[model samples]
Target: MTRPLTVALVAGGALLARRALRRRIGASPLWPMPALEEPVSGRRRENRRPSSHRVLVAERTEPAEGVVRLRLEGADLPPWEPGAHIDVVLPSGAVRQYSLCGDPDDRGAYTIATRVLEGGRGGSRELRERLHEGTEMEIRGPRNRFPLVAAPSYLFVAGGIGITPLLPMVRAAERAGADWRLMYCGRSRASMPFLDELEQAGADGGRVTVVAEDESGPPGLAFLGGLPAETAVYCCGPEGLMDAVSGALGEARAPHLERFTASAAVPGGAFALELRRSGRVLTVPADRSVLSVVRDELPNVSYSCTQGFCGTCRQRVLEGEIDHRDELLTDAEREDSMLICVSRCRGGRLVLDL
Candidate 1:
């Protein structure tokens, strides 16, 4: 009886040790995961995915009239750069990307401000009305695609809410003693965010220029001509302003652009997508995004930033000529993968390595 009890205890210990080893390997950053894991019972494992953090909305305040600033607190949160953004997931599962405008050194909390767009989607509206202090929310990413490049001089053009991402860059430039100038434009003083901060930064030196359309006419591109040829111009604003900046610069110099909106739709009618691993096919309409359709079939498919700016929904194109609409991916990344959120198939039928 004693011998049998000892054998049972040994078996239990071995089982626990095996589980601990598996957990350690799974958590290891060095652990290599296949592009597409082996299917279980002919279905891919979706729930066995990387988990996002649950942060406490520690504080909420109105910085501008219609803009709400949120201070999210978390433990051992990931570090982010100036232009990085975090995906704020709503209670209803809606995810919205907001730039991290707070100090990067502060790992305990993340600060993000969003302007309430009445005509736009419900993201900003939800933040304004629903989210509150002490609210627990899941967040993914602090990803950066609009990284500040080293240049002789910097020219930043920010319009209204577009200022969120560029604000950090301006602060970083000042700290590095880099030559940088910011041209901030808005509808009115009451509507613009971070005005006081910008004013404080400008007080010492006249590096910041605030232009309200009510007082002055729309910002003219005359300033563009005065800038040095090697100046790296970064612009984030409405489509019209971006177009004007691009047109003004011409081929002389290329300005780095960050769009708050998605790119123009892919010029195509309806197309069919085949989920190779799942063995399912779905039709995507011209007006509807591929993400919406893909979610209907595979409910657990990973996605964020429906605008195609984030590469979360990037799926391997097994056999399809992609329209490749997103600006986020590089020329090499476009060869095999596509952001299904905004991009579409140029061909009639496409296969995805789900």
Candidate 2:
């Protein structure tokens, strides 16, 4: 008489079962595959060594009241998509990224525009005042992570300078003969760049809506309810506008978002990090970053932006859980490495393969 407790499978069968289970787990969609490179601002860094090229400002003009447009020309310049951006190495060693707004087919030059922010970082002001026509500057990249995906219809939301990236997508959609609509909002008509162009596109009963805050205040969120079920939505704007759009769409159909702004740091206690090869330990304070502390020990380590947007400060994590705060690394990359500029330790002690 066989009992249920005494039943057993053959060793070979048990081994096959385990292997099949592993295969199924690996095939799961939730299982993250390693990204070839880190993604920044809804775009990924390509799996290639970056090279810098000198570009001349062929033309510069005030497209709007406080917005400046620049046509940067370089020899054999790489083409870019609507949502692609390039890093400009400023004269003062400050690196800033700007979206390519011009025609992608035009390989000789790239067009970019920036709105001056009086109360924000000085990069915009510096570019507006110092960089003139014929000014030569070094630039890196033309990466796109906010690429437009095919769908039956589309919705785009742009706020002020955020329109730079979406402008190209609109053109692409128009050329494809796809149904699309745009909700462009700004403080005023005079301050909005490309107002004339966008206005002209919507003139013959087109699908464009311009909401100037001075005239209509904040646009009502009721339009979100009327979107087609299969419409692909893209939004690049202020946090408030993005948040509102997200809330309206809900988790079921959230729009693809592009952010030039970094999210606020997570509130947590300070921690310590150990550099394995250097045999050095440093206490990271809440007020500072691991990059800053690490620089104190290894001053020559390369870093750029220092805001976790650029993958320049990525480091290997040998041991310990990470409190990832950057919008860069994917889950697979997070398993063994971290962007030291923004991420912190989930535990009290961290071991870095420095």
Candidate 3:
């Protein structure tokens, strides 16, 4: 069952369409990818303590070069939607987010994959070097920011390991019999994970287009602007690729984006922060993040990704207006809480439930 049930099944002389999509991860060549954080875009949230579950790494395999897929088995595991991501708490207490590239129908286990970033942060390197089968770890959230919506048609663009999140979306789109096209890009065909499965999915027609850099110079995105107004476009990959797709779309439409890293926030004015419980007041400089200033006051503040996508630095706002910046939180979440990493205060002062 490690091979995701991407293909549909027929029974009783009728077609049985499953709602869950076949999730897969492809490890591509050594692309200059900084962070493979899940697609945390169009994120909606409600304030709740997302529970953490204990799981054991039941199996490990190399789906492609520079990639490792881990099947974590846990009894009565929670179900996840397409484009959902789980937060892994490493042995070093470093938290990293990864997309769930497994059959959501199989709730007993969860599958995720990662690409080793040799020159970047140690999160992926730790997963590759330190983790193995039989190892126990903790996972959190199963939160979905990049959810597949009901669209007239879909145009999915994935680059390198960025295909992780879109895998489930592609599956769901096919199952729904929606008009969808996928442009999967990577370093080479040999390095792309789940190529055979994708090829098979699109075998009946030309639904999937593979763009290997070695074979194709670069992806031509001018056609995106020519798409129909009803087409829902989704793009996940390197910042430059996503930016290019956005650029091509121009004023026609804004494609739903899944980012590996956090987006840069505009520079806002400095403000004073009052930690209610800690009885501390700090000034958040315009140039620095609120997290940097808060950490100085309380050295052990729990935070990861420091870019606001992870929501680790979220603090309840007791008073004052917030200059919200992160894409991970929703409108309701902005009512009482704010991600201290990038968000700031609209007023000159504020009170926080730290």
Candidate 4:
């Protein structure tokens, strides 16, 4: 039998065995299943969460100009979905986020592409210039907020470095035999990574459009206009490209966007944040972030991404009002809680569960 058929047969047998065992146990008072809960609960209470994995740079290759592909050394790593990002703990103690660009089915190693920004905070530059093979670094998370949802067809639009996360999704869509098309836009052909792979994958009459900005006029909004209503559009790029796409989609189509920028700053005055645990009322400055204010007041508080993408700086809003600016929190999460990283108080005073 086929592998899937074998799996189905085993599952059916297991279900039958479980039903028979349950029937037999229903008549016996000494089955000991429920009695073992006490020990299980005790063990659960004692067990702590696993520590962050320390991954070594097994290999580093330059797939494109100003971009370095890093393969980390970890076989039994935690499972991660497409569009997931990992926080790399740099030597300078700076935590930087990078999208996982490798195949998610390959569990043996985690791969990420890093593009050195011209005015970046030295993380990418260091990775490109200084980091070498066998160098070890502390890695945390394969956290995902921009997950690929089920759609009849997909329209993926990526710009420059934004193609990193979409790479895996495209591979997954191909495996599932889903209808999808990718519009990868970059400055030039030489700057675009995985160009050869993308072209070869689509060589057998697949739909993949590579639009180089330097060689042609801007890809018009008409590109999105042709998409079917049943198709879900996914976009990731600079603010300009995102804005254009968003404008084209409007409220009628509502394309999903993964922002590479900080949340828009709200025009609001400063307010007081009351910590419920400490019974301390702290005044929040107009220019400072809630995470920064909290860190200044309470030095021991831990945080990873101050951009609110990571849930590390999350806090419950017990009372008062809030002006949420973080992209991490869902609409429901914003109603009950807040990400102190980017969110701020709306009214005069805000109460935090802390």
Q: Write one digit per residue (lDDT tens) for candidate 4, span 127-203.
A: 77666898988777776667777654677888988899888887866665555677878888899899888777655
lDDT of 2 by residue, 98-197 (tens): 8899988788999999998888778888898889998999888776657776555668889889999899888766655555678888999899999889
What's the lDDT for all of these models?
0.77, 0.77, 0.78, 0.73
* CA shift of 336, model 4, Å: 5.8
Number of clashes recorded per candidate: 0, 1, 0, 0
TM-score of each: 0.78, 0.80, 0.85, 0.79
Please provide, for model 3 over 48-133, each residue's C-alpha lDDT reduced to its tens digit, 9 standing for 90 to 100.
64578999999999998898999999976787778888889888888888888877778889989888889977899999988899
In model 3, which runs have C-alpha deviations exceeding 4 angstroms?
Answer: 1-47
In candidate 4, the residue pairs with backbone N, CA or C atoms under 3 Å apart (3 or more residues apart, or in different chains) clash, namely none
C-alpha root-mean-square deviation, each candidate: 17.4, 14.6, 9.2, 10.7
**Residue 51: error of model 4 in Å?**
6.3
Q: Which candidate comes out best when scored by lDDT?
A: 3
Clashing pairs in 2: 43-145
Q: Please write out the lDDT profile of model 1 over residues 1-354, one tens digit for every residue.
A: 000001012344444544543454342221223246344685433312123788999999888889999999999899777777877888867788788899887889999999988998788898888899999999877666677765545788899989998988888766655556788889888989998898788566567777888877688776576565656789998999898888888877788888888877746788888999999998998888888999998889887667876567888887889998885665656777888888898879889888
Cα deviation at 315, candidate 3, in Å, is: 1.2
Clashing pairs in 3: none
